[model samples]
Target: MRRTSSKYVRHSDEGELLWLRPPTRSGHVFIKVDPTNTSSARMAMGTQQVEVGGRIPVHRHDSQDEILFVYAGQGTVIVGDERAQFKAGTTVFIPQGVWHGVENTSDEPLQVVWVVSPPGLEAMFRDIGTPPGEEAKSLTPEEFAAVAERHGMRVKSH
Candidate 1:
């Protein structure tokens, strides 16, 4: 029998933090609620910090729908064929298989809280990100592509 508790709480600084480097993505991601830490099996939630001028390249999740709420700073967001201004308080819903991306256009860091249904993106994030205080190793573009592919994500080629 699987025994599980439904309650969970975490402080601002209390989460599994990871750092990502340039060319693919540049930011710090704090995974707060994931299958590894919580009892939920349907979704996962986290906060991502994208530095000024940083961008999360266009990509599509084959099986997960994602929701992103901007918590601070400003940027540009591409959803499918549309480009829109993304700022603090802005929210977006991206359906599965739809291509989307974000670029931080402000001088300050762009902080966004993201939730994905059918919890799987976190796995890809874990594979790509370096833990805080660890020797950061950046993945080659080819390597990144391979990992993304394995995670049911297809990134747009430049």
Candidate 2:
């Protein structure tokens, strides 16, 4: 069974009620979509903004698959042992248990819509991420690994 926040209920106007969570990684900000703010279960959605020169560290979800749609800027997506260029309109799929990460290689920020199936990761982000209006902080490798583990994910060695 999954848990949801009672504060939000999905509707076209729900966007006006959703709160923007803090960055989940260094140089990145995430806007989460889940049962907390949307009528979605089984899946979680969100938008992430990766600053210029920033990168999402290589990692893997043990229990959920992920899909990423690049909405702006350019970057490199590394999945397993392969790397591919991504830009606005590009889409990438990462199977569960596969190692993957993203790097913003352009001067502009990389904006992407991210979705994870079997929704639960959003709770992890909300728990581990810095809150809005607070100073952004980077998690130490050990801390990152701990959080990932708690969320059924693993930080990979690259």
Candidate 3:
């Protein structure tokens, strides 16, 4: 029932990193893949690098399911009421509307590749994150909520 866009391909090494700082949390550098540049309208994928001791805040996507694959380093992933240890090669599946977050627990950088269905979150990252080579900028809670809401997601309260 839907028309697909032309085929597209991008190498990870050639992607640009954006500094993403969610409200009241440490930021990570992310290489986001633009949905508009791809053929599928229902998927988005990219990688992120979190420095030691950094974490992405608790959040939920209202309309999209997510998969996070740990590419390197150690960390913990909190999903709903469960917590699990993650390391290189760990893969996590987060259903839509589930509360989830990630924390880098090791002394080295944590790298993860993430995919979201019904692609849109990458656009939110572009809207909220700072461009490469620029310092990361912090957002107020209200501002963060607004941005996330625009992309069909919400920042969960701690």
Candidate 4:
């Protein structure tokens, strides 16, 4: 048997929002489901809007597997050294320890929805991302890598 909860919903703008700075990627990360909002949730879910020409640098989650769904726009994705073009409706699975990254190649922003199992990557975004409306703070590549490492991710150097 599985536990159950009453129906719940989260609007597009109802979740926690964070702004990522350079050295990683300039984008808006919206964390919709995580321990903070759904204690029983076993996975973390969120959406990211990557600015034109911006990219999510190469990185790997050592402890969690991730699934990314391209919701809108187009982009190129690298998974373990293999690159592929992805558009709306494309889904990619990234196993734990596999290096992967996404680059927005289209003129419009690349919209992606990501889910990670074992729940926790949300903490990294919360720690490093600047709150919307606040002056975006910058982090050096090394500093960013350090923060990522603390959260079970290894970011490739730029």
Candidate 5:
């Protein structure tokens, strides 16, 4: 079995975010570590740092389940039909193929360790991701569906 911590492998050597697709998000810094470079063979971990009022819009992993561990600050997680409040030490599990997003609602930045089983699919999101400065504020009902359809990701609204 492998042995390592992504926290150590993906951190910045120069005090900036590292090991993610790119620094294209204004509020988020994501570092994804999978079996190839991490210890968990059946899991992928992404360390995320998001500033206040920042968020990842509702999205889903078509083939993976996810667990979000709140390490600091306050946030809200919209999972399927419900929006749950979270704080440090909170853990939320999101089953596969459901829509979800994490929003930093506190005054301080939010930190979360997202665990995705059997690797994750954010690479595709990265590919289609709008750069930080070009991100959309919010999508209309039809617009949201179109975006997901373009990526072949189904948008589920409970």
Candidate 6:
């Protein structure tokens, strides 16, 4: 028998990132729809919205694999060596350690839903004295390096 998690949390993610909490310097408005709890899979699924003319900083998930589905509007997804324009129905796969970023160019918001397998980013926040569903802030160059090293993340200045 499988036991469901005892608690379910819900909150606004970021200031710019809206769905999570304190938005970050990258404007990552994200929402974790299915967290790492006892849900469908041992993964984290989320919806992402990019405000008009806004974009996220380039970064990579060094540990988990990710798949993103563009559901609305138009935008550019920079993945590793290439930047691709995406729209409704475009699905992109991001392997672990591949640099990726998103931008919204349309007058409307760019909407996307993504899945991150083997969820553990929650613990990442714990280690940094931050929390999920909170605005993501920009760290100093040194600070960014430290966190990147700690989380196995690769930050690409773009």
lDDT of 5: 0.64
Deviation of model 4 at 149, angstroms: 0.3
What digit string (tens of lDDT, one per residue) describes model 4 on residues 77-116?
9999799999999999999999999999999999999999
Which digits, one per residue and each the tens of the lDDT, describe model 6 over residues 105-139? Answer: 78897877777776754344434333345544545
Which ten contiguous residues of candidate 3 have the minimum total lDDT? 1-10
State each model's CA lDDT, in order: 0.88, 0.72, 0.79, 0.87, 0.64, 0.63
Choose 5 or 6, whichever is better by TM-score.
6
User: After superposing candidate 5, which stretches have Cα over 4 Å from the reference?
Assistant: 1-25, 30-32, 39-41, 125-158
Ordered by lDDT, highest first, the candidates read 1, 4, 3, 2, 5, 6
Candidate 3, residues 1-158: lDDT per residue as tens digits? Answer: 11223345554544546777755455554544555655567788888887788888789999999999999999899999999998999999999999999999999988889999878878887778787677777889889888889999898876
Q: Per-residue lDDT of 53-137 in model 5, one digit per residue for the tens?
A: 7776677777788898999999888999999998999999999888888778899988888877766444434443443445434
Clashing pairs in 2: 42-118
The predicted structure with the larger TM-score, 3 or 6, is 3
- TM-score of each candidate? 0.93, 0.80, 0.86, 0.92, 0.64, 0.65
lDDT (C-alpha) at residue 38 in model 6: 42
Greater TM-score among 1 and 6 belongs to 1
RMSD (CA, Å), candidate 3 to true, equals 4.7
Give the winner by lDDT: 3 or 5. 3
Between which residue pairs do clashes occur in model 4? none
Runs with alpha carbons beyond 4 Å of true place in candidate 3: 1-8, 22-32
Output the TM-score of candidate 1.
Answer: 0.93
